[model samples]
Target: MSAAVTPRHARHTPGLLRSIYLPRTADALAFAMSTYGIPLLVLATTRSAALTGLAFALEWIPRLAAFGWAGSIVDRRGASVVFHLASLGRALVLAASAVLLRLHPSGTVASVTVMALAAITGVLTEFSYIAVETAGAAAGRRAGRRAHRVQAVLLGIDQTATLAGPTLAAVLLLAGLPPMLAAITVLSLLAALLALRTPPSPIAPARTPKGQTGVGLLTGWRTIRSLPALGWLVTGLTLSNLATGLLQAAGPVIVVKHFGQSTTDVGLVWSAAAGATLLSVTLCRFAIDRLGQWPVGAACAVIASLATLAAAQAPDYLSYLVLVAVLMAAEGGMTVVLRTLRSLVIPPEKFGSTLSATILILLLPFPVAGVLTALTPPDALGHVITACALLQGLGLALAFTRLRTDPALRT
Candidate 1:
């Protein structure tokens, strides 16, 4: 766990996201887009918001445990083989569910079927995603910086769905259900085939039998505890991820209640955020290398917190869009910098596991925030999310200082 600070280590990873890892990821994104559609489906079938959130969170929850093992496996092996296989497998899972949904459009069978599919796909996507990213990120080596850019690119492609998927589902509601889901099924299969073609991750030095310790579960914990720099990096990232989750939890609450919009409106606004995230990531390649991790992360966090608060105050569409743009932009740079620092901080053998550990910590907050927001008033939730974001910004600001980096940067 080295804390070499900012602007020094190369953290580029390219095309890996779209090339092979994407097929399944795209499907997952497609499904995530369909989350907006779920409430409508539930409304049509049973009208249960609780069930809808349960299914949605169910889709999201598995990653917390599954990613840990998946990350360890990637570290022991190379990224390509595991990534491809996982994509292929999840495609099968979706296909099966699509068939079940098609067969029973209005019954408990359909509802249960869709929920199960969403949950399984959600777990697999993040599980594999953590590994691919761990292998990529760079500052200048192109591979280092490329990882986040690759993420950014996929995000751009998926934003179209964020922009379109919910509306498509909403429109399809008038016509019927079978045709719309059938279309999604076809797209999922296409992406799966693409994942099959993703090239072997061009990681340096390759792997040796010695590197396959198969001890990934405990590796990140051990490594971070041993290294001060890595510890600070993980702590900072963990806080950032937790805060992001809190913010995410508050978005839907605000959209549906405050704005007096339907589920489709919520999806549309998130799509706007996704679009901004895409742009932010694209611009980060040139800007991130020169700016480095600390300043980039700190600035983004601070701005995002303010933007979130502003989102609370935003009364109309224009203000909402602007606020969402700044908030999304704030998130994207940290995605790049965080991955870059993680790669630079850890040894190759422990890369996947350590990254997974960090991700798991980040992810764990998601369900907690979801439940918390469900219980609390939206205004309180907004305040809580903003405060959490501010704390993370302060953490990043601390990392921006030389103390966290002095040990690792000194070489």
Candidate 2:
């Protein structure tokens, strides 16, 4: 007699294209909007680079802290519920700020408050990510594969938003600030509501030991330390993020100094870079079908490195943008693969917390790098890109060492 099939266990995998994924993706787009807007908005209203930088710095400060605690909560309480609460809070924070910004345009004090609230919302986003990530992992291998593919698509949409938000902020500036802020709030709320429909993720049938809740935090470190593949991947990723941070810190200056550019150029370049990620999305989708994560990810970084070198060498502004766009598109491929790998391997209940811990550990170098470059002369940004490329290349090499040696990594 044939074996009995469980109702939840379909013979073939279900399609991964949909998920309460849109709302989750939309929430990503919301922050893309907020981040893209922050620098520009600050510049337009306040005209102080230092103040804008301060606000940006202020927002990022809480994100690191939030990553640690929120992920743990997601593991213990619930991913979906946590997502909704945090997302709703994100909306309210922005909406309130919009109202205040409109009423008192000159109020730096109020702006700071709202900006900080926005920062809090930003913190909540990390947890929302945990929730979505948990849902993606709930379905097991085939389901997990599809889920991550969906994630690539989601991130593509998110990348598109990065371009769209800045463009929107620039265009909306003509209409004035209040309406724009209100629009951002509405968009965030819409995202939150959409996320509300996502069902709670199915927990693993295997029972974890008591006190495993707190274990999420330490366990991630222990896991990374213990697992050879995961450890190298995490280490490489952490180093790669640091290099990426340098690249990001140096990019605006590269445009401004390497080739004298207008203020408008910053937005234009950002749009170009984000637009490039669309191609990365395409490459990743193709790769997931033809190959696995590590190979494709390593290749992506290699391409980005060469592209960065090209950007460093470009004779003029137009040439630089073209190279930079190509480079970012390549980086996009790496990003997709990384996301897929992380989702496939991480445990469901602790998905958020583990990811949070991993990211917090990974992103530790970005702020320091930013400060380092800020203190450095802006004109020499291109030279720094070369240094960043070397660092990232080394990391990528280390991360992919196993895969390069053995064709099948996880399999």
Candidate 3:
């Protein structure tokens, strides 16, 4: 008798999951490192809060520009190739940054060079993120798993990286920037290799006729326009992101100047928040099932807003840390609910484009946030955060009201 053989799908599923999970986790880790490390390094080197804010904003500018075309390109070429190329591009850019740091050591030239490299890497990383996430969903379908479960696992990996990456970056920065950049380069290369192993996502059929190459770029916008509720949800998320951007740009400044804490402490606070986010993600499905996506998301937005207001008034480091954790947990849960809702509402063929458009809307406010942070006085940062939170609360209320009337949401 022939030896018993494992089913092909069973054997491939584990490998497929690894391929999707490893690269995504690595990419998320690299992103988090850069997100925290770059700002910390800028502040430490320049001692100019304005420059730090500018650098943070610069990272997202290119991402915003690329968002218009990235989805169409990925849809036309397929996500696997885009993902692999983006990974390689990021690795090369990081390696270049490490080399430049080794050469320049410290100066105005060094700062400018590092900032430029960060912006370029940010653009590449954004593209990689979109491709990998789209591919992961496709892989889940291929593996015969439910979409919600797959999304939960992917979100878990992301939260885990967010939990660990910042702390790792802060610790490594204590050693030096070059070492941190080197580690990121290695991780990027590893992501590239793993991308090679990932199963290819089937490309969306071209929506435009032959000879109408750029027309596909509009598909996502049209899709969003067709879905009234999704359009409103995206609009609400844009406001939420504005508040998030302000917090991101100003949080370190608050820790360093107001709390008089070290970079290590900043990392600790963020790590705690990330931990809370992970816990919230784990509980998200239960909440969504019990309360429904719209109600849970609206409740989360309210909680996040309240936490933001409280965080602004926090008198000490510990209080600020606790409020930050609570805020991040609420935001994390809301993110999961929004993602699941998007998956349910958007057609499979339109996912890449529609999601890219939504991400673009979500990120458009970061540069504005950076400008506001740089312009505002340190003493008034709390007032600004509180105002943004209130605006976000208002947007969420309107969005939820609209969602309640949506026929798709009723089911």
Residues forming the 10-long window of minimal summed lDDT in candidate 1: 1-10
lDDT by residue (tens digit), candidate 2, 1-411? 111211111112333434445765666666766766665666667777877777676667777767767766666655556667777887787777776676777766666754675467668666666665555544334554464466577667768777777677667766877766666777778767765555433432223233454555575676556556666777776666665677677767776766679767865766788877887797688776677666677787788777766776788888877877877787677666656666656644445556777777878878867886888787676677677767777887777876555433443
Report how far residue 382 has shifted in candidate 2, in Å: 3.9
Residues 13-112, candidate 1: write the lDDT tens digits. Answer: 3455455345535654556544565455555655677877787667666766676687666765555455555656666775676677677866789778
Candidate 1 Cα outliers beyond 4 Å, as residue runs: 1-48, 134-180, 198-211, 226-230, 241-243, 252-265, 309-321, 378-386, 402-411
Clashes, model 2: 0
Error of 1 at 136 (Å): 4.0
Which run of 10 residues does model 3 get worst, by summed lDDT? 1-10
> What lDDT is reached at residue 113 by model 1?
78
Alpha-carbon lDDT, every model = 0.60, 0.65, 0.75
**Per-candidate RMSD, Å:** 5.8, 4.7, 6.3
The candidate that wins on lDDT is 3
Model 2 off-target regions past 4 Å? Answer: 1-18, 38-48, 101-105, 137-148, 200-210, 215-217, 378-380, 405-411
Model 3 residue runs over 4 Å out of place are 1-16, 38-58, 96-116, 139-146, 173-178, 201-218, 252-267, 289-291, 312-317, 374-382, 405-411
